[model samples]
Structures are given as structure tokens and as C-alpha cells.
Target chain A: METTTLIPTGPPATRPRRSPARLVRAAAWIALAVLLAALPLYIDTAWLKAGQYMMIGAVGAIGLTLLTGQAGQLSLAHAFFLLVGATAYTVLAGPTDEERVIGLGLDPGLALMGAVLISALVGLAFAPVAGRLRGIYLGVASLSLVFLGLYFGQSLDSLTGGTSTGRTPATFELFGFPFSNGGPEIEVLGVPIRQAERIWYLFLVLTAIAFVLARGAVRGRVGRSWRAVRDNEAAATAMGVGVARAKAGAFAVSSAFAGLAGVMTVLWFDILKPDESEYGTYGINVSIAFLAMVIIGGLGSVPGAVVGALIVNGLPQALTLFSGDLGWFGETGGGGLTPILVSSFIYGAAIVVVVLFEPGGLAAIGRRLTGLFRARPREITREETS
Target chain B: MSAPTLREDLVELQVDSVTLAFGGLRALDDVSFTVEPGTVHALIGPNGAGKSSCFNVISGVYRATSGRVRFGDTELTGQRPHRLAKLGIGRAFQNTALSPHSTVLDNVMLGRHALTTGGFLSCGLRLPWTVRQERRHTERAVEICEFLGLGKVLHAPVAALSYGAAKRTDVARALAIEPTLLLLDEPAAGMNAVETAEMAATIRDLRDALGISILLVEHDMNLVMGIADRVTVLDFGKRIADGTPSEVQADPEVVKAYLGSGSEDA
Candidate 1:
């Protein structure tokens, strides 16, 4: 074999031109993030609670972004991790003095830590099988986890509170201060923030951390390997990437986030019940909701995950509020139908739009808009020079 | 052209008694050959001659039914592709295997994956050292891409590249690994005269600069004869002749199998 090696001539680096449109879009994103952070203070108590839910949902969605978006692995068992964490919290921290049902008699803070650790361990257990399977096979394997979780949640009465449902203990005290039900008030800029606001801030901090970590992952070497595997597995193998390990690691990371969300969910609601409906329980529907968030945001974009979570979560809440005032259906039926059915249809429709037209999701749209605006000045300058 | 004498004690890759059978049909029948290092080795034959099968076996894409493949002292018969890669064996497919959606830089960086150590968490966290490593890898990929005259399209998506450019990108990606043994499956199959000459020069440069052994599989006899140090001719899954380019080109069996009727046109 004659070995021919071509010396590559380096292309001259050119500075990217600035665009007003890109500036506007970036400003829009900054404005949105700022608005979201400040939203709790400006909104009503109901909407503030809903905003908190959306932020939590965004955190879970960011994890899904890593799994499905970057790694190109589909998972439908995210709710299983959520359930595990929530139940672990209740079981571990439930009334230390009461007649315990499979209770470990651990403190709430310790229980939360234990919940996260246990969920992470369980995620690792499923990683091997999940990693071995690809595309639809992986999807089916992960979906099975949800069924397994549901079975235990319903049948394991000692561990779970059973089908009857159970309340979590009030006052998850940290540093000798209560965090549940209007515990401590903090005055911020002459505005007194309630216990819920404090909890919201905690969730926000976690969400921010998740976003930064996910962003770094997507932009780094690991992210590149994932894209390579997703694009061409054979080539990736040829490049000496451990395809199975990369896929499995993505699943574990995604599951860890779900577990964290579960802990927060229990703290927010003061309950852990598996038999409750999709909205109430961390079930299959919640998994779908998370998937929708990723798809709408942009499959591989970190920022897209947050955008998607807000769209998918916020739209339904807004619609329900609208439906309640309009009285479209019966008083009791209107709120549920609008959020569940209509929001689902919208979610489904948004996914189709994303897949067909803008596969990059909201992130791609943002990039394009930026590029368009950035190129304007260059175009004008060229025209003038010519 | 002067006949370059073969080194009597060259540390060649030896394939001994390798047989590959697919169901009832045998693709390779007790095939055996030696590829000398620091020289171009050509594996050429008619269609269904098991040339590709031999390439596949040596590159760890296919396992031999009964044989031993030794690269220096290591047995590479049943190793996985990645393991083989780690052992310094790099392969470029006949079909361009570049990721169409990724940038040229990203595609080449895939080659350096084996060299990098940080796992998912390290990369995700953007550890100071990992970022520095990434910059160095990107620089290397750029250097390799520029070497292949693909620097102009470094940031461009592979999907936007022409067939010839894409093929060159594959070679660059394989070379980025800095392999001890490089396998090129018809690297000049679809290039024009200018591109072919450029490719030939690039191939020679690779050997001189990298000091890696090369295995070239090509149908273009003129191009093969121009650069190959030693050519092994195969017919019906058996080695018909093996010698210096001119010697193999003049062999009666090679003439009968490849250039019918021993014509002057050959």
C-alpha cells in the first residue's frame, strides 16, 4: 500500500460579523431568564407555585436533554427515579417516633441525601442493560422500569404508603430552622419573601447548577463523542470510543437529576404517593412531559431544554387558568381538560414541528436568528466595498 | 525505475493460514501473506478475490476461521476494532465514513478520542486541564485537516463537502490517530488527474513524516504501480504473485488475471 499523507493548508481565520438580530435574540433570552427568576415575586401565589413546578420540571428536562438530545438514547423510565427518591424521603423521614412501616428513622435532611444516593445507585444498576440496547430497544427497556416502579409502589405497602396515599412530615428543618409551611421570612429590597419563596430560591439554585453542568457537558469532549456515536456508531468504535459506557453514563446522569427532582417534589407537596394521577404522582405521563420539554427545547441544546420546559409546563397552566374563567366545560372539568388534553395535543404538535422543520429545536432557531442579524453588517460593508 | 530490494529481516505483519467462510461459500481459503513495514504493500485481485475480506480480518472487522495474525509480536486475530486501533491500526473504509452533519474539525477530533483520558464528567465539568487538552486536540485536528488541504472547510459541515473532499477528510481522520499501520481502501477511487496526483504526493508525505506502514488497495494499476514498494497479486482467494511493482506487473499469472492476453495495453 502506498501511504500518501496530504499536509493540510490551514484556512485563514475570519472574525464573525455582528448582527442586530442576534443581539435582539440574545437580549430576549437574557430578558426571559431574568423574568423567570423574578417571576415568583411578581406573580400571584397560585402562579408562583406553578412557576416553581415549571422550574423543577426544567431541571428534570435538562437531564433528559443529556440522555435523548446529546446521546440519542430514548428513556421512558425517568419517573421511576423520581418515585424512588420521593418514597425514599417519606419512608426515611416519616414520623421518627410513630409506629414505623419499613421506616429507617432517619432525619429529613439525611433522608433526602439517602434518597438521591439510592436513586443514583438504582440508575447505575439499570445502566448496563440500558446501554447495551440502542434506539427503540433502549426505549422499551427503560419503559419497563416505569412498570416495575409502579408495581412496587402499589404492591409494596410497607415501603410506599400503599394505594391509600400518605402525607410526608411537615417542617424539613435545616440548621435548626423549619422549611415547610411558611417557616422563615426574609426581607429582600423591603419585600418580605415567604417560606415558599425561600423554597423556590432553593429549587432555582439547583436548576441553575443543572443548566451550567449540562451546558458544559454538551460543549465538551464527551458531548462530541456522543454526537459521533449517535451519528455513526461504527466510526465512533473505530475512533476507540467506548460506545456502551458513554450511553450508560448518559442514562445515569439523567436519572440522577430525576431523583433530585423527586426529592424536591416531596418537599414541595409534603406527600409521596404513587397511586395518584399523572399530575399528582411521578408516573409515565410525567416522563412524557419531560420528553416533550426536551423535544420542544431542542434535542441537543442545553438552553433549549429550559425553553422547552417553560413552554410545555407554562402553556398548560396558563390554559387551565383561562379555561376556569371561561367555564368552557363544567366548573370541575374545565381546568383538568384544558391542561391535560389541550396541552398534550399542543405538546405533540410542537414535537412534530420540531422534528420536521427545526430539528435543532428552539436553540437552532435562536442561533439562526442570531446569525441572520450578525451577517447584516458584513453584507452592507461588502456591498459598499464592491 | 530502480527495483528497491526487499529487506531480508523486515518486521512484517504476518497472516498465517487465515480462512473466512460465510455459510457455504468460502470468502478466503487458507489465505496467507506478509506486509513489510516502512513500505507500501498493495493487495490487488479481481472481483470476489477476498482482498476486502483480508483487509477486514487484519483490521479486526472480521475474525478468521482458523489463522493467526501477528503485528510484530502481538496476536490481533480476534481483537475488537477499538482495541486494534489502540494497538496502532487505523483503517479508512472504501465508502466515505465521515459524519455528514458534523464540522470537519469535529470529525477529525474523533480520531484523537483514544488518546484523550477524561471521561464524561471531566469533560462536562470543563476541568481546567480538560479544556486545555481540548484546545490541543482541536489544534492537532486543524493541523491534520490543513495537511489534507481541508483547512478551508474546517468549520464547514461534512454534508456540504464534495465527494473528493469527503474522501480526503476520512484519510485525515484516520491519520489523526497517528497509527503504526495505515489501511487505505482505494483512496484515489474517484479523484481526477489533479486530485490523484495530489493524493499520491500526500501518501508519500505520510510515510516520510509519520514513518507508518501502509496497506493500499486500489484498482488503478497505474497509480498503484507508481507508488507501491511491493505488490501482492491475488486471484480466486489465493496469492498468485508477490514482488516489487514491476516484477508483479510482469508475472504471467498477474498478466493473465488482470491484463488479459498479455497485451501491450497492460
Candidate 2:
């Protein structure tokens, strides 16, 4: 999972624990975190909403990268897991007074955990099929889950609230403080931290946790096992990594992330609306969008996945916000330049550019840029060692 | 870094009349050999002579058709491949099957998977115990790498390594498993003469220092004869000779298997 662009020559003595380059990298990350934490203060509600949407994408993309990139499993069933998560949360936290839908009336915090767990269990159930197939076959096999999700969404109207008019999810709360606007009003830097501001901070915290956890896994023993399984099954087995278990674990973890993203999706819209078609929310298009985020970012790269999510999800939201001011990205009678269409074109082109010029994606390019700045020494070539 | 201590109760690996068949073809027919404890044993045969098949069956990658492989009192045939590591058996591949993109240290750390304990949650959270475990195991892995002369390229990607270096890295990884029995398949397969000599010395040094039994499969006869205490010769899926290197080298059946059976008839 760790792909180094700069190949250093010489002995291990040159590799220091805290090199100047590493300190610079650490400082840069700290600065980015501080800036993101401060963004909610200056940005308007619309912009915060955009950032929240991107955070949702970031969480989902991180999961996909671990499974598809690190574990080397192609999965197209992310949308199904997302649906599972969204439905689970809604049913668990929806008001018991509702006549149309089932509600466990669990606390919102508990419901969120329940949703992620349900999604992970659903993912584990699919692992049997995932274990048998590889590459495109596994991908196609997993796609069936989306159709199943669609069927459940329509058939289980009591649970899904009949796509026409979805159920409203209970406002999320941490202990006594609610994420909704009705809670005790709070002000940060004289900016009234309303629901939008609150949710933005909520998402920021979640995304940061997700990012940190994923990085830890990538750098730890679990990440090594996944990469080992990805590289060679026989060797992985010989190295004492259970091939099937590793694959199943990867699927479960990835699904849990997608589940969290699903909960975020419902919160973002304030409604648990299941997709009517395979092209709507929690549809095949959404699955491909998540894949696009990972691929455009770089397979198996934690931070790269975030950058990918920002581009793929943040672009459309940014464009929509800008169009409100420019008024040129209005929907056409036929198929003209809408924000979604324009953003789609941009990301599609970006994928093509990444594939052609840099198969390593943005992460590799970032490594190369940093390597150029360092200009250490000539890397030991294959010929030199021979 | 302190040297990793070998298990005191090292036991011999016994392959007793193992036969592995695939459909109508018999990859290994009644092949048998015993690797004495703390000694280097080599399985040598021509191309397509079931050397790798024998290795695979013993390593639990391939189950035998009719036979038993026992490491001391434990029956190993029915055990899962992943369980072999737990049985104190560590194997290095003939093709250097280390992950190419990962750093040498990371690849070596994988050998410590069975020894360490942690899952996604514990590792992802970097819990106190997991962190301590990682640091301690990492220290051992670094020592193993340095032992294999991979100290210079410890952080280098396996893909960037030379063929000899990559092969050594594979051995280093196997050593990281902390096994009482080490299975090395063609350790010097694609190496130059100097590299082959170095590998021979390393194998001898490993046996002497770690007190671990080494089972090797090699086409390189010089390295095998130099380091292997006992050599097992196979031909046409059958064990032709098993004895000390000099005794096996003088055996007529072994000569015919390597050269041509027609030579004796002529």
C-alpha cells in the first residue's frame, strides 16, 4: 500500500526518523487540518453544505480504496451498502409515533452505530460470493446487490417510506445537543452556528476520524495483510494470512464506511429517500462515482482518496453554488450545461488524463513533485544492482 | 538488535510415502524424505521432476493423494496452508513472491502476521498493545533484514531491488516468521555464481545460528551439494536416492535421472 516515488540509494543510515522533508510534510498536514476546522467560520451555509457533501464522499471513497485498492477486490455494491446504512439509521431513529414506518426509537448516536453495523453485516454476507470471484466477475456479482436494494426500497414501503415521499430522519444529536437548528443557539466567531454550521462541524469531525483511522490501518499490520493478500494469495497464505478472512474483513470495513456515508447522505438531505431507478441516489451511478473518486485519487492511497472525493463530489456542489451567482449553468430543455453535467464532463476528462499520463493518480504525482523538490540522489537502478 | 532465539524443541520434518496426483497424472509418486532437525536438507531433481510439487505438498499448498507429512507428532497433510506457519514451518518461494510495490520492511513485516495479534479496529485505532507489538516485531524484522544483507535496502521497494537482493529479501521474510523449520524453494535460482555462494553460506549460517531445520529445492547443484547435509533425488515423480551428498552423487539412478537413462543403455 505504501508506494514510494523517490527511490533513495545508499545505506539505511541516510533514512532518518525525522528528516526535513518529513517535518515539512507533517507541518503541511497540520496546517490543512487547522484551515479546514476554521473554514466553517468564514464560509456561508451553502458552502458548508458543499464541504459536508464532499466529506461524505471522502468517507465513502476511503472505504472503497481500502477494499478495491489495498485489498485488490473490485466491488460495485457500495450503493447497496449505502442504502442498507441509510435505511437502518432511519428505521432505528425515526419517531415511534409515525404510522407508516417502523421505528426502534433508539438514540440517534446508537442508531448511527447500528446502521454501520448492519451495513458491515450485509457486506459480510456477500463475502462468500466475493471470495469465489475475482476482478470483473466479482464486480458483476456484487452489482446484483444494488438491484436487490432497489427492489427492497420499492417493496418494503413501510421501511423505505415509498420513494415518492421518504420518511424524515430524526435530527442527529450528541448527548443533549442536537445537530438541528432548534437546539440552544451557539455562536462561533460571531457567526451564528446554525444547523448547517453544526452539521459541517459534525462532518468535519467524522471525516477527520475516518481519515486518521484509514491512515492507521494503511500503515499498520492490517494494511500489510491486505496488501499481501492482494499481491499473491498463495504467498499470503504461506505468510499466515487467511486469504478468505482478509477479503471478508476488507469488504466489511469498506461497507461500514459506505454505511456511514449513507447516514450522512440522509442527514445532508434530511430525508431517507430511496432511489426510484438505478440512476438515482444510491444507484449504479453513485457506485461508479465512488469508484471514480478512488481511481482519480489513486488506488490504496488514503489522502489521495480524499483529494479524489473533493474533485468528484466537491466540483458539482461548487459549480451549483457558483451557478446561483453566474446563472449560466441552468438546466436546459433538452440536455444542456447543467452543473451536474459540466462536473461530470470535468471528472470524466480527469479520469482519462489520469489513466493516460499518470496511472498512479494524483498521489503519485504529489510524490513526484515532492521528490523533485528534495532532489536527493540518483536512485539505484535495476542495472546498477545487477 | 538481539538475535531471535530458535525454539529449543526443534523437530524433524518427515514426508512419508507422499503421492500427489492430478487427474491421471501423478506429480509425486511414493516420494519420501526426512529432514533431520537443525540440518539443511535439499531436494534436487531435473525440470518437471516434481521437486516443486513435493515442496508444495509438504508446505500444505497441495494435499497428498496418499501419504502423511508429520512435523514431530503433528499430522500436517490435512492442515490448511495458512496453518503451516503456526506449525513452525516458514516457506520462501522459488519466484520471490514478495509484494513488489511494498517496501522491503513492509514485506518482511508480513511474515510476523501470525505471530502478532490485531485486526482492523485495534490496528486502525493503534491501540497501546498493538503499537507496542508493532514496534517490538519491527525491531526483529529489521534485524532479520540486516542479517540477510538487506540493511542498505530496508526501505527500498521490492520492485526496485536487484534479482539477488529480492531473493534475499524473500529469505529475510521467511526468517521473520520465527520458524523452527524453514522451507526455501530455489533460493539461488536466478543468481550469479557469487550470489549463489553467498546464499549457500547464508543457509549454512542460518542453520548453525538459528538451529532451525532447512528444507530446500534447488536446480543449482553446487549450492545444494555445498550446503545440504542430506540430498534427496527425485526422478519421474519417484524418489531415486536419499543420502549424504557424496553418496547420492555416486548413485547410478541419480546419475541417470540428471543425464539420460539412454546413456547407461547405450
Each model's DockQ score: 0.42, 0.42
lDDT of 2 by residue, B163-185 (tens): 99999999988888888899999
lDDT string, candidate 1, B19-96, tens digits: 888887788888777877778788888887888888888887788888889998889887776776677677776787
Model 1 scores a C-alpha lDDT of: 0.77
lDDT for each residue of candidate 1 in A227-284, tens digit (9 for 90 to 100): 8777777777777877787777777788877887888887777667676444446778
Docking quality class, candidate 2: acceptable
The CAPRI classification for model 1 reads as: acceptable
A316-381: candidate 2 lDDT, tens digit per residue? 999988988888876755576998999999999999999999988999998888778864533432
Q: What RMSD, rounded to one decimal, does every model reach?
A: 5.0, 4.7
Error of 2 at A251 (Å): 0.3
Task: Estimate how well candidate 1 is docked, as a DockQ score.
Answer: 0.42
Candidate 1 TM-score, true structure as reference = 0.87
